[model samples]
Target chain A: MMEKYHIESYCRIKDQRISLNGATVFESAETNFLPFIKEAYKTLDTQYPKFFKMDALSKLALIASDLLLKNMTEKNIALVLSNRAASLDTDRRHQQSIEEADHYYPSPAVFVYTLPNICLGEISIKHRLFSENGFFVFEQFRADPLVDYADGLLKMQRAEKVLCGWMDLDNEKYDAFLYVVAKNGIFTHSKKKINQLYQTS
Target chain B: MNKVYLSYNNIVSGYGFDTAAAVEGIKKEDACLRQIHDKHLLPNHYCASKVASETLEEAYAQLRPKEAHTHLEKMLLVSLEKTIRASQLELTDRVGLIISTTKGNIDVLEPENPFPKSRAYLGQLGEKIRHFFGFQNEALVLSNACVSGVLAIAIAKRFILQGTYDEVFVVGGDLVTKFILSGFNAFQALSDEPCRPYDKNRSGINIGEVGTSVLVTKKTTHLAEESVVLLGEASCNDANHISGPSRTGEGLYRSIVAALAQSELNAGNIDCISAHGTATLFNDEMEAIAFNRSGLQNTPMNSLKGYFGHTLGASGLLETIIGMHSLHQNTLFASKGFQELGVSEPLNIIKKTTPKPIETFLKTASGFGGCNTAAIFKKVAEK
Candidate 1:
C-alpha cells in the first residue's frame, strides 16, 4: 500500500509580503528587490553573515526555508525546489562581466551561483542536511509533479521530511512558496492541496 | 524489490556517433581529446573533446530533418533517436523522459546569440526533447550541479519503485561555451593539456561536451546483450561548502556506505570502480579519501576524464555506459593520463588494459555543491 504524507508547515513570499499558512506575516510596499530582501532577512533576527554574499534567488530561498523550517531540527530533510527562470538573474550578471573583450573579467563568486541547485546547497549547509535533494526547472509553477516527487521520496523512505516548492526570481520580481512535507500534519499530501497553497496569494 | 535494468544506451561524443563507435574507440585506446585554438572560446589552446558542428547538424538532420533544434537539442535528438529505435518501445503513457544538464543552451544568453533568450532555460530544452519524442508524460529535468546525470538514474528508479512509470528515458549533456569556459577559468580549474587524474603532477580539468541516453525499464524481456541490473543507488550532500568539496570526504564516503548496505554487498564484491575523477587536485584527493574510507582501496578503478574531459552533468552517465561495456566485455581499460599514484592512500588504479571476468562495478560522481552519488550494477545472469 502507498503511504500518505502531509504538509507540516508552509511559507510564501510574494514581492515584499510574507505569509505563513495562508496568513500574512509581514507586508511592505517596497518594490526594490535589495531593500525588500534585506528587510526580510533583518526581520528574521538571525546572525548569518553569509546571507549578504548570496544572490537574490538564494537569499529568497534561504529566507523562505528559514521561516518554514523554524523550530524543526531534522537532519534528514530533502530539498526539491523548481523555478522558471533558473539563475538567469545571476547568469546575466556573469555574462555582463565578460561581454566586452577589452574589459572582460568574470567573477568566480557570481559564476558559482549560475546553477539553480546552488541554493539547495546553501540550505543544506545551513541545516546540515545530507539527504536526497533535486532541483528542477519548469516553464511555470508545477504543483502535481512537485507533490508527486516529494511524496515519492517520503514513501520510498528516502527522506524523513521534504522541503519543496517553487522559488523564482528575475528582474526584481520574485515569488517563493515553500512548504515542509512530513508524516504528520493537517493537510493531506495531494496535488490539489499543493496547488491551493501555491495560489494562496 | 522491483528490478530495474538500464539498456539500449547510446552516446554522441567526439569519438563517434553511436554506442558501438564509442565502445570501440575506448577498446582501441583512442583518446578523443583534441587541442582547440579558438580565441573566442578560450583564452589559450586547450585540450578538449567537442563534436564538430557539421557532424552534429548531419546527425540531427538524419533524425529530425524538418525540425530546427539548438546544438544541445541536436545532440540529444541524435543520441535518443538511436536508443529509442533499438528499444522499439511504444511511447505510451507509462513511459517518461528525464533530461540531466547543468546549463542547457546557455550559449543563447550571449549578446550575439541568434536564438531567443528563453532558450537558456533548461525547461525549454526539456520541452523541445519532449515534444520531438512525443513522450506521454511530462519531462523531468534534473539540474543539481554535476551529479545531475547519475542522480537522474536514481530518480528514475524511484519513480518505477513508486509505480509512477514503468520505463524512463534519461538523456544528459552539456556543450562547450564561452560562458562555461569563463566560469571555469575564473576558478583556475581549466587545464592547458589533457587532464591526468590521480597523477602526482596533475593539473586542472579540461571541459568536454557530449550527449548520452539510456533506457531504464523493469521488464527484463527486452534487455539487450549488455544490459546490467541496477542494484542500488544513493545521493548525499556534504553540507560542507557550496563550491569546495569536503576535505574529509564525508558525503561520498557515507553515500558509498549506504549504497553498499542497500545492495547487500561488500566492497570485496565490487569488481571495479568508475570514479568521478575530474583530474583536479581537490576532486581527485577527495575521491581518494572517500574510496579509502569505504574500503574500496583495493578495487580496480579508472577515471575516463582523460578521454572525455569532465562532461559535467553528462560525465556520470557517459562513464556508466562505459562501465556497462566493461562488464559485458570483461575488459578493464587503463586510466589514461595517469602516470603515478597521486593521493595519500594507495588505490589499485588500472594502469594497463587487461581482460578479467568482470561481474559487478560501482559508478560514483562528485560535483559542485558537494553532491556525491554512488550506484552499483551487476551483470545479469542467464536464464
Candidate 2:
C-alpha cells in the first residue's frame, strides 16, 4: 500500500480567532483585520520587526505560517498558497493612491504589496525557505489544488516538505488556513481532512 | 511518467493575432511598444505595448459571441479559440485548464466602468474563461506575479503526468491599465525608451500587454508541426526580497539548476536561453550573474523585450512560443535593442537574426514577491 502524506500541523485564523490543531491559540476582541492581526503579533512578542511593514494579506499569512513553522527545523519546505482577493485589499489602496489627479502620490512601498504572492515572499524570508513557491488564486478556500500541488512536489522529491495554505484578505472578510504536509503525522493529509478542519475550526 | 508535449498555441498582442504575426514583426525588428499619451491609462508619456480594444473586438466579432466581454476576456477568448481550433480537441473531464495572469479585469474596478467590482476577482475571471468554453474541470487560476504564465505550463505538465488530466489548456494575459502602469511607474521601473535587455545603456523595462494560450497534452496526435517536449521545470523563491531581485541571483540560479537536474541534462544541453530579461538594471544584471553561474555565459541568448517589451504574466509563455519557432526554423532571433554588453558577466547575446542548429532551450521569469520559475524544453521532432 502506498504511504499517505500527513497533516503534521494545521493553523486556522478566522472571525478574530486563531486555532492550531483545533485548539484556540489566539483570540482578539477586535473585529477589524488590522487590529486583530496586530494583536496576534503582539502576543508572539517575536523580534522580527519587519512584520510592521507588511500589507494586510502578508500579515495574516505570516501569523498562521509563524504558528505552524516557528519551531520546525525543516528549511526545504515549499510554500503553496491560494487566495481569492489576490492582494485586492492592497490593490484598492494602490488604486486610490493614483485615482485622483490632485492627490496622486503612488508610494512604492504600497505598490510593492499589490501582488498576493508577496506574502509568500514574506514567509519565505522569515523561514529562510528557498524551496518551491506558488500562489494560486481561487474563488474560495479550496483544498484540492493546493494539496495536489504539494503532493506532486513531495512525490517528485522537489521539496522535503510543503507548507500548503489559503490566506486571503479583502476588507473585513478574511480567512487563513495553513498546514504542513509531511510523510507522517497525527492526521492524514487529504482533501476531506482539510475541509473538515477549515469548516470546524 | 507520461511525456508532456506543448502543442498548438496562439498569441494576441499589439503586434497582431497569432504567433506567426508576432514572429513576422520580430523578424523586421519592429516593436509593438510606443509612446502612450492617454491620461485614462497613464498621465505621463510611457513606452508600453497597449493592444487596442477595437482591434481585439474586430477579431472577436468573427467569433460571434452572445454578449459583450471585458477587454482581457475578449483577448483570451480570441487567443484560446484559435489554439483550440488548431489543437482540434474537445473539452473533456479528463482535460484541465489553467489561467495565468498578474491581474485580471482590474480595470473593471475603476469607478467609471460599467461592470460590477466583483468581476475584478481572479476566480470570476477563471469562471468567465471556463464557462465560455464549457470545460469540465475547474480552471486553475495562477497569480504568482510575472511567473504565472510559464508556471502555468509547469502546473499543467504535472497534472497530465500524474494522470489527473490527459491534457490541459493553458491561457495567460494581463492588460496595460492605469492599475498596472501607476504601480510600475511608482517603482521607477518603466523605461522612457524601448527596453534594451543586457545593454550597457539600457534604461529600464517597458510594460506590454499580451494574451497567449497553448495546449499541453500526453498524446502525439494533433501536435503542432514544431511541438516541443517538456523536459524539466522548477519554481523557487529568493527568500531575500519581495520586490527586488536577489543581488547574488540565488533564487534564479537554484531554479535553473533544479530544472536542469530534473531533465537529466546540464548547461551543455541548453542550446539557447529565453531569459527573464526585464531590462531593468538590477533584473538584467541578476540574470547575467545567474546564467554565468549556470555555465551558460557563452550560450546564444536574447531577450525579446525590445520587440514586445516586458509582457509581465504573458512574457514567459509568449517568449517560449517564440523559442519554439526558433527551434523549428533553426533560427536565433536577435536580442533587439541590444548594442553593448552591460552586465559584468559575458554572454553571447544574439545581435542579429541568424541560423543555428538548436535542439533545446530554457525559459525563465522572475517577478515581485521574490518568485522565479525555469522551464526547459527540447525539440520533439528531432528527438
Candidate 3:
C-alpha cells in the first residue's frame, strides 16, 4: 500500500512581496532586492545572524524557508531546490574581482557561494537538517519532476518530509516558491497541485 | 521497489581515455599529475591532472561532427556515447538523463569569449546534452559542490523506486578551468606537488579533470559483467559551517550510518572503502573521524584522489567506477601516496596492491558547504 503525501505549507516571494499559504505575509515598497530581503529577515526576527553575510540567493532562500518551515520542528526534511540561473549573479561579482589585469584578489567568501547549492547548506545550518539534499538546475519550474523526486523520497522512507521548489535569482530580480510535503495536509500531492501553487501569484 | 543495477560505465581522465586503459594504468600504480604552467591559473606552476585538450577533441570528433560544443560538453558526450552504445539502450520516454557538475562551461564567461553568455548557465548545458542525445525526458542537473556526483546516483535510484523511469543515465564532469584553479588558489587549497592523502607531509589538493558515466537500470538482461547492485545511499548536512566541515564529522557519520542501515548490513560486510580523501588537512582528518565513528576503522580503505587528483564533481563517480572494477578484479589498488597516519584516529589504509576476494564496498564523499554522501555497492554475479 502506498502512503499518500500532501503539501502541508507553501510560500512564494517575488516583486518585493511575499505570501504564505495564499495569504499576504509581506509586501515591500522598495524594488531593490538587498533592502527588501533584509527587511523580511528583520521582520521575521530570525536569530540567524549569518543571514547578513550570505549572498543574495542564500538570503532569499533562507527567508522563504524560514517562513514555510515556521512552527514546525522536524529537521529531517529533504531539500530539493532548483534554479535556472544558478549563482550567476555572484559568479559575475567573483569574476570581476579577478578579471582586472593588475588588481586581482579573488575572495574565498565570494568563491564559496559560486555553487548554487550552498543555499541548501545555509538552510541546513540554520535548521539543523541532516538528511538527503539536492540542488538542481532546470530551464523553468518543472513541477512534475520536482513532485516525482519528492514523492520518491517519501516512498523510499528516505525522508519523512521534503522542502522542495524553485529559487531563481539574477541581478536585482528574484523569485522563490518553496513548499513542504508531508504525509497529510490540505492539498493532495499531485503535479497539478504543485504547478498550481507555483503559479499561485 | 525495483532493484537498480549500475553498469556499462566509462571514464575519461588524465591517465587514459577509456576504462580499460585507465584501469590498466591504475593497476600498475601509475599517476598522471603533471606540473601546470598556465599563468591564468597561478603565478607558480602547480601539479594537476588535466586531460589533454587535443585528446578530448580527437575522441569527441570521432563520435559527432565537430560543432560548437564546449570542452566539458564534449567530454560528457564522449563518455556517455561509449556507455550508451555498450548498453544498447534506446533514449525513450522511460529513460531519464542526469548530469552532475559544479561549473558547466564556466569558461564561457571569459572576458573575450565567442559563446553566448547563456551557455554559462548549467541548465543550458543540460539542454545541450539532451538535444545531442535526443533524450525524451527533461534532464536533471545536480550541482551541489563536490558531492554532486555520488548524490546523482542516489537520486537516480530513487527515481527508479518511484516508478518514474526504468533507466537513468548519470554523467558527471568538470574541467580544469582557470575559474576553478584561481578559486582554489585563493583559498590556499592548491598543492604545488602531487597530493598525498593520509600522509603526514600532505600539503593540499591537486585539482583534476575528468568525465565519468554510469547507467542505472532495472532491466537485468543486458547487464555488463562488471555490473554492481545499487544497494543503499544517503546524504547528510553537518549543520555546522558553510565552507568548512564539522570538526566532529557529524554529517559524514550520519550519512554512512543511514546508508549502512538501509543496506541492512553492518560495517563488517564492507570489504573495502573508497573514501573522499582530498589530501587536504581538514578533509582527510574529517574522513578519518567519520570512518572511525562508523566502526570502519579496520576496513581496508583507500582514497583515489592520489590517482585522479580530486576531480571535484567527477571524483565520486569516477572513484565508484574504479571500485566496481576493484570488486570484479579481486584487487585492491594501493592508496597512491599514503605514507603514514596523519589523523588522530586509526585507519587501515590500503598501502600496497593486494589481491583479495571482495564482494561489497562503500563509496563516501564530503564536499564544501558541509555536505556528505555515502553509498554501498555489491558485485553481482553474472547469470
lDDT of 2 at B319: 91
Report the Cα lDDT for candidate 1: 0.89
RMSD of each: 1.1, 1.1, 1.1
| Model 2 misplacement above 4 A | none
TM-score, prediction 2: 0.98
Q: After aligning candidate 2 to the native by TM-score, how far in Å is the CA of B194 from where it should be?
A: 0.9
Q: Model 1, range B1-383, lDDT digits (tens) per residue?
A: 78999999999999889978877887777888888898887677777889888988888877745667888889989999889999999999999899999998999988888899889888889999999989988788889888998899988988888778999999999998999889998999988888999998898899999999999999989788899998989899999998998998988998899899989999999999999888888999999999999999999999999888989889889998899999999999888889899999888889888999999999999888778899999998856
Question: Docking category for candidate 1?
Answer: medium
DockQ of each: 0.80, 0.85, 0.84
TM-score against native, each model: 0.98, 0.98, 0.98
**Candidate 2 backbone collisions, by pair:** none
Q: Model 2: how many Å of interface RMSD?
A: 0.8
TM-score of candidate 3 against the unseen true structure: 0.98
CAPRI grade of model 2: high
- What shift in Å separates residue A54 of candidate 2 from its native position after superposition? 0.8
Number of colliding residue pairs in each model? 0, 0, 0
